[model samples]
Target chain A: MWKAEIKVLLKKSVLDPQGQAVEKALSSLGYGNVQDVRIGKYLEVSFAAGSHKEAEDQVREMSERLLTNPVIEDYTFELVEV
Target chain B: MKFGVVVFPGSNCDLDAYHLVKDVLGEPVDYIWHQEENVSGFDCLILPGGFSYGDYLRCGAIARFSPVMKSVVAFARSGGLVIGICNGFQVLQEAGLLPGALYRNLSLQFRCYFTYLKVENRQTPFTSGLEVGRLLKIPIAHGEGNYYADADTLRRMEANGQIVFRYATADGEVTDTANPNGSLTNIAGVCNEMKNVLGMMPHPERAGEAALGSQDGRLIFESILKNWEGAR
Candidate 1:
């Protein structure tokens, strides 16, 4: 079995309203040094795969096909043997 | 003309679409279930607004994989007319039937208000009866109606005339002050490259009658009917 940790984030060019709101809340709490904040999703999955190479490719495809939207979001994955 | 309004599990606006078509528009319409796969024989298909699949994972993410959406995507690929409203618009974007994705409102609030929109494309069957640049008052009800896309895709969509509607002032000026949801470029609606599919953030059904506050949305239905009539 292989385990994968995936992170999905809105593209840098796209505005992150939720993140900005959180940033404001943090700033109001006295953390004024914070310049910016961007929010994203993180997911972990365990699946059966033959090899590390196969798992990496499969997870990448899954991220592109369903886990992240190419138009507005980007995704990255790290795979490990379980 | 006949219409099919797909009713996903949490679709609150299916009935609105059905009532608008059958009672108000005086046309034949059916309520299609989310699990159903066939979408044939309908002049147009509507994916009504609501939280499909409980909005799990992401807005329109899980619902994009629903059984009916497979057929909806197939239908749109074959040049069938499909209109997605609000949550439906998110589904269309997630299903790859349309361009761009919706983001949480800039204010981080679920906004329910009347917003003015400018008709950007009169060539589409969905807007053929309406004049380009005409301002339409429509109600938007959603937390994630702000639209976004990469710069390249945005440029291409603009050049291709895929941008169909933009949030505008009452007097019809597209500006940030008029953007209730903070969508990139103030886009309220967009069509696919083929112009057969449209995904809009506003609820045209809700605003289709004067008693509801505005009758500007009626023109979209009228435009659809006019197109069908002309084609037949």
Candidate 2:
């Protein structure tokens, strides 16, 4: 089985309102030294594949097609065989 | 002219769109199921607002893969009119039929209220009835309606006149305070490069009747009808 872990975050040009709210909360808790915060999504998918290369290709396709909106977001993934 | 409204699994505004076309506009309309692959015999198509696919993964992400979308894309490419409202706009962005994406509202709140929109481009079939800088009172109800596009894309859209509407004050001024979602440049609506596909965050259907507060929303539909008739 191959497992793919994906992380998606809004591109730098796009505003992360949810992250801003969280940052405000942290500041209220005396974490004023923190520079910034950006919110993102983490997803894990496991499936049977022929090889690590095959798994990597599948994960990339999935991320580009549905896992992320390339217009406002970017994604990174890690593939491992189990 | 005949109209078809696509009904995704979670579409809640399908009926509203149907009513606006059939009862209000006195035209023929039908509901097109998302699972169906064929979309013919219709002059225009509408994708209404809703939490399609339960907004899983991301808003409009999962629903964009619906079978009917393939046909919708082909229809748009063939120069057919397609209007996406609110959630429909998100779906259009996800499907790559429209430029840019609707990001989470800057206020981190689901805003449901009346907002004034300034018509930026009056030549589109969807806005032909309005004059430049015309103000229309429309209501927006969504959590992710803040429109975002890269600087280069925005510049191109500006040059192409693809931008159609912007949040504005009652006096028809585009300003930050009038922007309900902190959208870039107060953008509320845009059209594809061909200008046949329009995607907007505001719900014109909700404001189509005077009893609902304002009938300015009808102008958009009227514009489409008038322009379509002119083209024919």
Candidate 3:
């Protein structure tokens, strides 16, 4: 079995509106050195695959098609034996 | 012209769209369930607002994979008119029918209000009879309505008049404060490069009649009707 940990974030050039709001809240609470903040999503997916390379390829396909929106977001994944 | 409104699993506004066409506009309309693959016998297609696929992965992302979408995409490619409103707009972006994507509101709030819109391009069938820079009072309800496109794509759209509407002051100025959702260039609506497809974040069906508080929205439907009539 293989487990995939996926992370999705808004493109660097795209505005992270919710992240900005959280950053502002942090600063007002005296966390002045917060610098910047960006929000992202993490997903844990497990499945049976022939090999780790096959699992990685499958995860890549999933991310490119459904897990992320190419227009506004980007995604990356890491696979491990479970 | 007959209309077909696609009803996906989570569509809440399909009935509103049907009412707008059948009861309000006095036109023939039909409901196309999400699983169906055929979209014949309809001149125009409407994708109404609501959370499809429970908006699980992303708004419109999963819905784009619906069986009916294949036919809708084909219809659009054949130059048939398609109107996507609110969540429908998000679906079109996912379906690649229209340019750009919508993001969460800058204020991180679901906004529901009667906002002002400026007619950006009046030459297209959707706004042919409308005056340029006309101010339209329309209601918008959504949490993710901030429109964004790459600078190059936006420039091309500008040159081709793909932009159809922009949030504006009642006096017709496109200013920072007039923007409700922080959309790039105050964009509220846009058409495909061919001008056959339009995706907008406003709820035009909700504002279709005076009893609903404004009749401005009816013009969009009427425009589509006339376009169909004029073609033949």
Candidate 4:
């Protein structure tokens, strides 16, 4: 068994409308100190595999195929021995 | 036809979709909770509209991580038919099963009303009952329906003919009034490269009855049935 930590984030250039709306609301509430805000998702996935390399490969494929949208999001993963 | 509708905690439209599928379409359907890990017996799976997980983090953020989504993703990858409507569309985007994200309405308000959609690609099983360029009257209720995608992705989608629907007027005129949300290229719906997975923001189940003023939404379900019948 191996543990994988996956971080999924929208591409830097993509407009995050939800974050923008919150920013606007904060400004309206008189909090002008907020500079930049971007929202993202995180997942900790666990699976049983023989080796770290195979586990990492599976995590990468999962991220690309279903965990993250390549067109708008970028993801990175780290595998830990269990 | 046997169908399954995934039901998350905050899913308000699951029953509505259940009735539409079982009562309106005269098909057998079941509601599967979001925590389930299997979805093997159904021919079709639907993620209906509503504020899943109370729209807690983002529109569909929390719901995307539901255990049921794993099965839904597997089903879609295997060429099974899946439809995500309204909030369901947002879930699909967050789950990375579909391209693009549904952003806040360009006007920055929650919009709830009837809108028109132009069928762009009828080759898909979802739209095969409609002619290309035909208009559909459907209701849309969402705050994040403004679709956004990069230029390259949009070009690829267009080139591959994956765009299934565009906002249009009732008379089939492509106009801005019908575009409730300022979606990129006025895209209302799209399919995966294989055209088996569909994500759209309109509530087709809400328009299946004539008492709702138009029964046009039935055609979408009918198209799915037609495709399944032909495949069998």
Best by lDDT: 2
Give the per-residue lDDT digits (tens) of candidate 2, residues B180-210: 9989999999999999999999999988898
Q: Can you list the residue pairs that collide in candidate 3? A: none
Ranking by DockQ: 2, 3, 1, 4
lDDT of 1 by residue, B11-61 (tens): 899999999999999999999898998988887999999999888877888
Candidate 3 to truth, TM:
0.97
Which lDDT tens digits does candidate 2 get at residues A1-82? Answer: 9889999999988889998899999999999987789999999999998988888999988899988989989999888778
Better by DockQ, candidate 3 or 1: 3
The full ranking of all candidates by lDDT, starting with the best, is 2, 1, 3, 4
Q: What TM value does model 1 have?
A: 0.97
Chain B TM-score for each model? 0.98, 0.99, 0.98, 0.98
- TM-score of model 3's chain A: 0.95
- Report clash pairs, candidate 4: none
Q: Which stretches of candidate 2 lie over 4 Å from their true place?
A: none
- Top TM-score: which candidate number? 2
TM-score of each: 0.97, 0.99, 0.97, 0.79
Q: Candidate 4: where are CA atoms >4 Å away?
A: A1-82
Candidate 1: the clashing residue pairs are none
Instruction: Give per-residue CA lDDT, model 3, range A1-82, as digits (tens).
Output: 9999999999998999889999999999999999889998999999999987889899999888888888999888888899
- In order, what DockQ does each candidate have? 0.80, 0.95, 0.85, 0.20
